[model samples]
Target: MNRPLYALLIAAAMLSGCVTINIYFPAAAAEKAADRIIDEVWQLKKEQGAKPEGNQP
Candidate 1:
C-alpha cells in the first residue's frame, strides 16, 4: 500500500527472476576416481605388517 513497500516488492520480484541453477554429473570422472582409490588401498594392504628394510618374518 505504501511507496516503500511497493518498491521493495518490485525489487524482490526482479531478484527472484535473476536466479540461475547449474547441475553437473560426471560419471566418467567418478569411475576414474574410484579406480584410483582402490589401487591405493591395495598398495597400503601390501605394505602392512612388514619390515621397512628387513626380510625377517
Candidate 2:
C-alpha cells in the first residue's frame, strides 16, 4: 500500500509539471476589426447627412 501511494504521488507531480497554458493575440485581426468599425461609422454618418467632426466637406 505504501509503495503504491508513493508511486501515485510521483505520477501526479510529473503530470502537473507537464501542464501548459497559452494565450494568443492577433494584431492583424485587431487592425481589421478597427477598420471595419471606422467604415461602419462613416456609412452611418453618410446616411444621416452629417459630416464627420473635424472634417471639411
Candidate 3:
C-alpha cells in the first residue's frame, strides 16, 4: 500500500513539471484592438446623433 502511494505521488510530481504556461503580450495587436474599440464607439455616436430625438413614431 505504501509503495503504490509513493509511486502515485512521484508520478503526479513529474507530470506537473511537464506542463508549460505561456503568456503573450503583443504591442501591435493591443494597439489594433484599441483602435477597433475606438472606431466602434465613434460609429455608435455618429448613428445616435443622426437619429431624431423625443420618440417620434
Candidate 4:
C-alpha cells in the first residue's frame, strides 16, 4: 500500500511539469488594430480639409 501511494505521488509530480500554456500576439498587428479603432472612435476626417479647432499652432 505504501509503495503504491509513493508511486502515485511520483507519477503526479512528473506529470505536473509537462503541462504548458503559451500565448503570442504580433506587435505590428496590435498597433494597426489600435490605430484603426482610435480613428473610428474619434471620427478623424482627412478629406474635409477643415482646420482642426484646437490651440495647436
Compare the candidates by lDDT and give the number of the best one: 4
Angstrom error at residue 8, model 2: 15
Across residues 1-57, which tens digit of lDDT does each residue of candidate 1 receive?
Answer: 599999999998877766532235566567656655875986545344432433434
Quote the positional error of residue 8 for candidate 4 in Å: 27
Q: Runs in model 2 with CA error above 4 Å? A: 1-22, 44-57
Candidate 4 least-lDDT 10 residues: 48-57
Q: How many backbone collisions does model 4 have?
A: 0
Count of steric clashes across candidates, in order: 0, 0, 0, 0
Pairwise TM-score winner, candidates 1 and 4 = 4
Residue-level error in angstroms, candidate 1, position 51: 33
**Candidate 1 ranges with C-alpha deviation above 4 Å:** 1-22, 44-57
Clashes of 3: 0
lDDT value for model 3? 0.63
Model 1 RMSD, rounded to 1 decimal: 13.9
- Candidate order by decreasing lDDT: 4, 3, 2, 1
lDDT of each: 0.61, 0.62, 0.63, 0.63
lDDT of 4 by residue, 1-57 (tens): 599999999998777645431234556557667766877899974555343333344
Q: State residue 39's C-alpha deviation in candidate 1, in Å.
A: 0.3
Best by TM-score: 4
Clashing pairs in 1: none
